[model samples]
Target chain A: MMSLRSFRDPVLVALSLVALWQVLHHIAGDSAITAPAPTLTHLWEMIGQARFLPHLRETGLAFLQALAIACGGGILIGVVLGGHRLTGEVAEPILVGLYSVPKITLYPVILLLFGLGMPAKVAFGALHGIIPVVLFTMNAVRNVNRTYLRTGRTMRLAPMQTAWFILIPATLPEIFTGLRIGFSLTLLGTMLGELFASQRGLGFLLMTAIELNDVKTILAIAVLISAFAVLCNAALLAVDTRLHRGAAPETSGK
Target chain B: MKKATWIRTVFLVGALGALEVACRSGAIPATMVTAPSAMVTTLVKTMQSDEIGGHIEQTLSAVAIAMALSITGGFAIGFILNWFPVLRRAFAPFLAAYYAIPHFAFYPLLIVIFGLGSTPLIVLATLFAMVAMIVATMTGLDRVPRVLLKTARIHRLSLLDEIWRVRLPAAAPHLLSGLKLAVAYSFIGVIAGEFILSTSGIGHEIAFAYDNFDNPRMYALILFVLAIVTAFNMTVYAYERRLMRRRGI
Candidate 1:
């Protein structure tokens, strides 16, 4: 499926999209609708004025705090539950069922418990994120090839040594996969909390701009947020690829 | 396996019982945690009333429409990408990046463009659902073995015949998975949209109840949603399992 492709097609597609956008802007003049140029200019202005930083910092801090807890706790709990066959079997169905329920539905409960503040946002984000991390890590731990352990045992490796070298290496790829998914969910959960009831953050800014009908600023924020998502995902993907270097080819196509 | 099921059931029941006790004993504040019995009563009352029904209908319709559009649109987009490797290559990075961002963040712009109504909700849901569909469709179509195509050619099958008989079956499983994902995301997107801007729908009900501090109604609504989602998940899971069994997987 990975075919040799010309370098020009994306550039062509992007340019055509911009051209179409400009055409629409011309056709729909004088309304509050955001044109590409104005949105970009507003984005630049916001950045220059450093108005985006505080909100970005707030969002980032909450996300980081949640991610830290989710990664540490999720991995630990997942390993324990998944390492034992009996517990893994009992937990799998329950976890999957819980995961199916939209995590956002629990936002109200989080807000109620933690109130309309950073703690609520952080808890919400952590709750949303921990599921995928736990699920993936559990699966990775459970599905570690028996042959690897057998090999370790034959080599006279201690249980801990075997776990460190064999089990950990075997699960790293899936762990990375979970981390990536968990990170995205963490971002989503934090944003949802902010959108739901926060006094400040990117989501708050988006809501404010919406209320004011500031289409340009709204669009600008949208673009910036999308760019941020893209950038973070790219960075994570780079790290994931490095960690999974030898395994890339096998996992790539599907 | 039987022991596991028993254990799981007992655990669930025990947790519910604990919550009920906690709520009743005032260990947890009533405003924060509605008692289990109260939640049940509220659910029953809402079912008797048409108010909850209307919200359910609104939410379901939006989700249904969004799911349909995303499936069709995503299929087309995926096909186009499959047909053009260059475009796919160029767009791969952008596409991968989308997964990191919450699609709900774009709802404001959607509202600006589509105006305040189901239009924005449906559009947002479709966008959220369609990404997974597109990816699934691409991968599914890619899985159409060369041998099948060769056989179709050897049999002198028409394009439509080849697609219906050979390609569709080959891609069915992945497409089905995409459909499941689309369904889940559509529900999420529609609900989130309603919560943010809509004046109606179950999401609106939940938000309204939350704002009004109608703890029973809010808890009941959440339970209702959880029930609906869990039922949907079970159905999908059963269907997937059946398909797998049929394929001897």
Candidate 2:
């Protein structure tokens, strides 16, 4: 007799999870693998606390730097590859080869080359996350109407001229999509790097909390990080939507 | 042309060889960086070692299991969501936010909550990859030719039968593409998890090498990983291509 509206709400999901926790704990009692579900009051109390701000700034800076590097590198490479047919064809396979390799394996190499610092984290983030941007940008640029290019050539448009006036407008949607993924994965890479081996950043803080077994502090940091992630995601989506608002109807085909 | 292909291949080989030479000349200031032959030797030795084998097994199992579970779950959710497009419409923003957020950023929390072995890795992989799979599957279903569906109706196939035999078949390429992407995505997730959080895996080894500035070991491991991925891609491509050619897909 439950309302259909209650079927899949996040609230309902949380409730169900909590109930399952209670049931399991009641049956198996307590163990290292299981922690009794904390009441909402615990979460609220952590939210009400301070000292999580500096850690937030540390993670945010890394996230931002990583995003910038990935977006910049990916877009430049993507556009260059997309601009010329020969480069596109040659770069296509190499880029895929680079992309297909387990980037996680590159972490040690990146750290070795760049050393254990923000630069290493930034470079790792860019390498891990930039592949999607390159792929999508290449796709967007490649899909430019051949007729449009021919016409531009007939009109004596310089290569840059064509790129600025027509290609960017036509390819903005896909480029934005690529950037969005690029930024998200950049954040992921930076966090992973920090978590695995670092002296600073939100991930380092989280790891420290884990080692200390301070459940309240660990959950608080997590909540803050998740909230940051969600905010960054929303901002990226907004940028993506805004960039393509000029030409939406054309891409309804996709 | 064949000549162009050969040139590209030659250039790539030459560049890689040059990179090895640079490493050997000690021009890069990283002693761990070395020639391709050295990397090959390292890889060969590591593979022959039992500890390396165990590391590969641990990393591979996490990836394999996480991938299997995520694919099944993604496909199921995708099928259902596509069946009811209203759900997608209602939750597209939430979906965007979910995928947008660095799910890895939450891994530390997961490690805290789940106390990592494989559970957190699996959850993160499934969560990260399923969104793409579901979106792909839904898009595939959304593209089913209206005329074809009408024609099937005219032929009096049951609704359920049409879905099982026709719609699913029509969406096969997209679903497979989703699976292809999920392959890399899930592997990325598990590797990241193992690297950051676990003590026994390729990731852990990679992290150790990075910390120690063992550049040669790191490059060898990268080559080893790249080989595994290439093998996986070739197999999937061959299978998918053969399947497509058979079905006229």
Candidate 3:
């Protein structure tokens, strides 16, 4: 019923957008670029060709690899910093310092050092993905239950054992949240790297389409990118829900 | 705790400095890895040349104007959306879905429609940032407590008074969070815009440096951007702190 009502609400805006697109299509018809439908169709046709998959694979593989490295590195660093109060406090400001800087500025360095290949892209993506991962990991570690810690100590558990058995479980949920953010950023970083210089990748395709003024292909690829992002987000969210359910206390009612 | 903090700080800083030194002076080629000292020289040159300042100013001007415009626009739309649930039900999903849409892809379309430079850049930033404010304001207003509203209605309080005394203040925190996120989005939009096709701007500087393989110059720009962003973040942090203090938040 909610979806049905939602559908009823936007008919006018939808109609108006299409109408404006068509008007712009005809009135500014001086160049082939004026209309959106043809470009949209170009986007569609690009998908039907066999050439699309390679770039997608190249981009996705590089992104996934970078994300894994970043996740591990970020969480490890974050855990060490965030485990203690003063260190966490001091490190928080420093993280914020680095986070604000646009990572795109490092593209030249990455390309020069890593040689314009998937390695460069992966490194760039890892840098992009790591900051948030570190931030959230710190938060997760700081938020471990102190009372639980006292109980574990009372039971004569070794420090490492307590951390492994106690803190890790509690940190899982927030760590997952960080991973989600990091994963998205990894994609953005990889795409940006590819755009700067790549023999093969989605970013390369996007640039190619734009430079060629092939609006349709750009739109088609864009659709694929958006679909991929949504799919990734949904996948992360599913994992998050599962983790949340598993982490919940076995008993609820008094 | 203080000892831990000091240890971590010393370790991280020392590690970074060591790594930088290794990358710069070790077996790695100078062409491959620009030294920190070299990067500093590059930054100094860019500053002396006043080339990057113009670009920074251009980017900041767009971000400031776009953010201000969106704040007003978002507040208005959010209020209106709250006033009419019919509109809310209609537009909310579309807005939510598009929020995640990279829209960076359609950036070229923006260029097609609006041409090169500030118009497309500023407009895109505004559009991207505005949605959050609208959603935040709408949700905040919708969740206004029932009894106070009932009492106001029973007392026949004017709509203006009810909104000012009740809704606005109550919704302040959410609105501020929305505004903060909007600022981040605006920053992203400006950079992405410049990265894609702008003739000038900080993003253009990075792209050009990369194209030319000017590693030190690129590193300089990145550090400069980091400093600027850190400054922006402090401003927002201060603003948020002041608001919280004022509101007893």
- The DockQ values of the predictions, listed in order, are 0.53, 0.37, 0.39
> For model 3, which pairs clash?
A39-A216, A42-A216, A43-A216, A43-A220
Candidate 3 residue lDDT tens string, A134-218: 9999998887777779989899999899978888888888889788778777777777777766789888888887788766676
Compared with the true structure, what per-residue lDDT tens digits does model 2 show for residues A1-254? 33354235534544665577567546544332134335235556654657555656676777777778788888888888887777788777677667756677777767667877788887887777789899999899888777777988999999899978878788988988988777666776777777767888777876786676555555555555555666676677767877777666666554
Ranking, DockQ, top scorer first: 1, 3, 2
Rank ordering of all candidates by lDDT, starting from the highest:
1, 3, 2
Interface RMSD list for the candidates: 2.6, 4.3, 4.1
For model 3, how does the per-residue alpha-carbon lDDT over B100-141 read when each residue is reduced to its tens digit?
A: 455666677777678776888998878877887887788778
Give one digit per residue, the lDDT tens place, for model 2 in B1-249: 565466678889999888878877887555646688888998898788787888888888878987788788888888888777566544554565564454654565566566657888878877877777877788789878888799889989999989987898888878877787777778788877777667878877877776676767777887877788778877877787898999775
TM-score of chain A of 3: 0.77
lDDT of each: 0.82, 0.73, 0.76
Candidate 1 residues lying further than 4 Å off, grouped into runs, are A1-24, A27-32, A50-52, A241-245, A248-254, B141-167
Indicate the docking level reached by candidate 2. Answer: acceptable
For candidate 1, what is the DockQ? 0.53
lDDT (10s digit) by residue, model 1, range A164-227: 9998888998888798888877877888888887888888988887777677877787778777
